[model samples]
Target: MEFGLSEDQVMLQETIRRFVADEASLDTIRAIADQESGAQNVLDEKIAALGLDGLLVPEPEGGSGLGVLDAILVQECFGYGLVPSRFLANTVAAYAFGASGSELAGNIASGAAKFGLVLNDVVSRRDSSGIQVSGTSVTGKSLMAINVRDATHLLFYSDDAIHCGAPDETSVVKTIDRTREFFEVAVAGADPDAKTADVEQVFAVASVLIASDTLGAAQAMLDKAVVYASEREQFGRVIGSFQAVKHLCAEMAAKLEPCRALLWHAAHAIDENDDEAITMAYLAKAHMSDVATFIARTSTEVHGGMGFTDLVGLHYWFKRIGVNRQLFGTPMVLRERAARQQGLVA
Candidate 1:
C-alpha cells in the first residue's frame, strides 16, 4: 500500500552515490576520453568489487538475487554519477540466462563474463529442423551498442529467444556523449546453436532500469541548474533572483518529480507481477524520456553559454540524457506502443 523505498534500499542508493562521487568523479570521466575501454576496466573492477555486477544474480550464483525495485535504486545512482558501464545489458542477459537455467548465468553473475546489447531489430529462423538458428546479421552498425569492445558476448533476441555470440572486433564510434562510448561493431560469426531463452520478462526489466537512469540524470541536471542559478549574478543580482530563471528551474522540477513516482511504481509492479506491469513500464519509459530531455535542455539554458562547452562538463549529463531519450525507443515510440498494448490503438 505504501510507495517508498525501504531503509535498506535507501542505504543501497546512498552507498552507490558515495562510491561514484569518490571513485568516478567528473574529472575521472574527463580524463578517460582517449582510452575509454582501459578506464572502463578500472571502473568495472570497482563496480564488481561492490558486487554490483551480481546485483541481479541469484545468491547461489554469487549475486545479490535482488529484484527489479532494488535494481532501480542502484541504477538511479549510476545515472546521477553519469557512470558508464554495460551493467544494464548484463542485467537483461542475466535475467534471460537465469530464467532458462543456463550455467552461463552464473558466470555473468560472478562477473566472470561481460556482454553488450544489440539494440536493433533481429530475426531468428529455424533452419529446416526447427533447431539450427540463423537469421539476421546482428554484427553491424548499431546506434547504442554500449561496452562492445569489452564485452565477451553480443546479446540479442528474436523468435522469443535470447542469443549470445562473441563479437569479432569493435571500433569506438563517436557519439555526442563523451561520458560513455558506443561502438560500431563487427559481430563475429555467432554460434548458430548458441543458448536461447525466450521470455518477455527481460524486456520489462531493461525498460525499468532505463527509466531509473533517466530519473537519476534528470534529477542531477535539476540540482546543478539550481545551484548555478543561485551563484551567478547579472546586473548586481543573482540570476536565480530573476523570475525567468526561477520559473525555468521550477518548471524543470515540476516536470521531473513525477517521473520518480512513475518509475518507482513500475519497478514495483514488475517485482510484484502486477497485471499492469507492462503498461506501467512503458509509461515510465515514455514519460521519463520526455522529463529527461526537458531537464537536459532547460538546465543547460540556465547555465547560459558555459553550458555547451566541455569546460563546464554539464554537456556530459546533457548528452547522456540525449542518448537515453533515443536509446531503447523514443518517447513517441514508447507511447504509441503503450497505446497499442492498452488497446487504445490498433
Candidate 2:
C-alpha cells in the first residue's frame, strides 16, 4: 500500500504553517510569555477564530471530524511556531468525551467549553498527590495540570474511571519553558460524572500528539542551525565550509527526519484502531524524546555562543523541545511500557 499524506492533508499542513508564520512570530510569542496571566488566551482566541478547536470533533456534532493523523499535522505546525495554546489538552479531552459518548463532546465541538487535562497520573502516580473520586464529587490536588487557568472543566482519571469537574483553585507551576502554562489544580466536591473512555487509548493519543510537537520543534532547530552555518563566518570562511560543522548538520537531519515517518505511522495506528497502536505510541514518544534532545543540543552547538543568547531566540525552540520530552512519559518510562506491552519485559 502507498503510505503518505493525502493531498488534503498536505494542504491542511500548509494552511496551518501559513497561519503560524503570520501570527506566532518570535515577537508575539515573547510578548505573550511576558504576561503574568492569560498568556495563552491571545493565541487561543486566534486558533478558535480559525475554527481549529473543532479539528477533532465529529461533523454530525459540528466539528471538522478529522482523525488523529490530521490533528498531528496541525500540532506539528503549532510546535514549529512555538504557538502557545490548549490544542493538545483540548484535543485529548474531545477524544475522551466523544469516545465515552458524553454530551460534553458537543460543548467541545462548538468551542463552548475548554478543558484542562490531568494525565500525569495515568503514567506515574504520586503518593502525596492525585485527585480522588467519590459519589458525584472529586477532591484533592493534581499537579502539572495543563491549561488549568482557563479551563471550564478538568478531566482526570481516578479509581479506574475518568472524571471531569470544575477547578476550585489553581496555582502556577514554574518551569524552564514559560511558553506554556502548568498548574497545580485543587478540586473540592466538584462533579465527577464524566463517562469513561479507554484509558490506554486516551494516553496513546496524548503520547502521539506530544511526540508530533517535539518533531516539529526539532525540525525548526535543525533548519535554524543549517541557516546559521551557511552565513556565520569563522577565520574568513563560512562555518558550513568546515567538515566538522557539515557532519553535525548532516547527523541532525539524518536522525530527525525519520521521526516524521515514525510519528505518522503511530498516529495512523490510533486512527485505525490497529492492534499495535498503543505500543507504537509509546515507541514513537520514546524515540522522539531522544532524537529531539540530540537535535536541540547539536543545533545549539552549531550556533556557537549566540545560540544561548536571547537575541538569537533559539532557546525558545530549545526549551519547547525540552518540555515535550518530559510530558506524558519520559523516554525511560515510555520504553519500559513499550517493552511490557510487547512481552519483552516483566
Candidate 3:
C-alpha cells in the first residue's frame, strides 16, 4: 500500500492549514486564552463553514463521510497552528453516537453541540445503573480536561457504565490552559450509548489528537528556539552556531520524529481497522507523551529564561504540550499497557 497522502488528502490538509494560519493568530490565541468563555466562536464558525466539524461522520448523517486518515490530516494542521478548539472530543462523540446509531451525530457535527470525554478512574462500577448510565459527584476534578467550558455534552467511562452528561463549569476547577479548560463533571445517571473498546478507542483518538497538538507545538517551539539562538549571541558568538546549541536542536528533532512516526502508524492502523491498531495507539501515546515533555523542556532551556515569559510566545506551546502529555493516558500508564501487550511485563 502507498504510504503517501492522496491528492484529496493533500488538498484537505492544505485547506485546514490555510484556515488555521489565517484565522488563529498569536493574538487570537492569547485573547481566547484570557477570555472567560474560552470559546473561539469566530474560528469555530470558520471551521464549520469548511465542513470540518462533519468530516468524520457518515455522509448520510451530514458528515463528510471521511475516514480517520482524513481526520488525522486535518487535525494535524490544527496542531501545527495551535488552533484551539474541542475538535477531538467532538470526533469521539460523533463516533460513539454514530456507532450506537443515535441522533447525537447531527448535534455533534454542527458545532452547536460540543462533547468532552473522561478517561480517568474517577467513577466506580457499582455506581452504574446500565450500559449507558452511571452516577458520580458534580465536583470530580479531572486533570487536563479538554473543552469543558463550552461543551454541551460529555462522554464518560467508568468501571460500571459509559455515560453522558451536560457541562457544569460551576463544578470545574481552575486550569492552566484556560482556552481548553475542563470541569469537575458528575455522571448524574445519564446513559452514554456505547461501550468502551478494549484499547479505549475514543480516548485513543483523543490521545492521538493531543499528540498531534504536541508535535505541532514542539515544531513551533523548535522554530522559535532556533531563531532565538541565531539572533541572541553569547560570549561573542551566535549560540546557534555552537556545537551545544546545534546538538540541542538536533535532539529535539530526533525526539519529535519518533513521536510523529508512532502517531502515523497508530492512525494508519486505526483507519485500516487492523487488529494491531489498539496496541499501536497505546504505544504511540506512550512515545509521544515522553517526547512532547522533552521537547517542551529543551525548548525552554534553549531559550533560557525568556522562554517562560509570555512575551516570547514559547510558554503557550510549552504549557499546551505539558498538559497534553498528561491527558487521557499518562506516559507511564500507556507504556505499561504497551509493555503488557508486548509480553514484556516483569
How close is every model to the real structure, measured as TM-score? Answer: 0.89, 0.96, 0.86
Off by over 4 Å in 2: 36-39, 189-193
How accurate locally, in lDDT, is each candidate? 0.77, 0.86, 0.70
**Positional deviation of residue 236's Cα in model 2 after best superposition, in angstroms:** 1.5
For residues 1-346, could you state the per-residue lDDT of candidate 2 as single tens digits?
8899999999999999999999899888887778745545667788888887677888777778899999999999999988877788889888887755666777887877888888888777678788887787677787888878768887787777667787788899888887888888887554545757588888899899999999989999999999999999999999999999999999999998899999999999999999989999999999999999999999999999999999989999999898888888899999988898889999
Q: On a 0 to 1 TM-score scale, where does candidate 3 land against the true structure? A: 0.86
Per-candidate Cα RMSD to the true structure, in Å, reads 4.1, 1.5, 3.8
TM-score of 2: 0.96
Per-residue lDDT over 100-180 for candidate 1, one digit per residue giving the tens place of the 0 to 100 score? 566667888877789887643421122321111255444343444677766888776545566777776566768887777
Q: Better model by TM-score, 1 or 3? A: 1
Supply the TM-score for candidate 1. 0.89
Sort all candidates by lDDT, best to worst.
Answer: 2, 1, 3
Give the top-scoring candidate (lDDT): 2
Clashes per candidate (backbone, < 3 Å): 0, 0, 3
Of the two candidates 1 and 2, the one with more favorable lDDT, higher being better, is 2
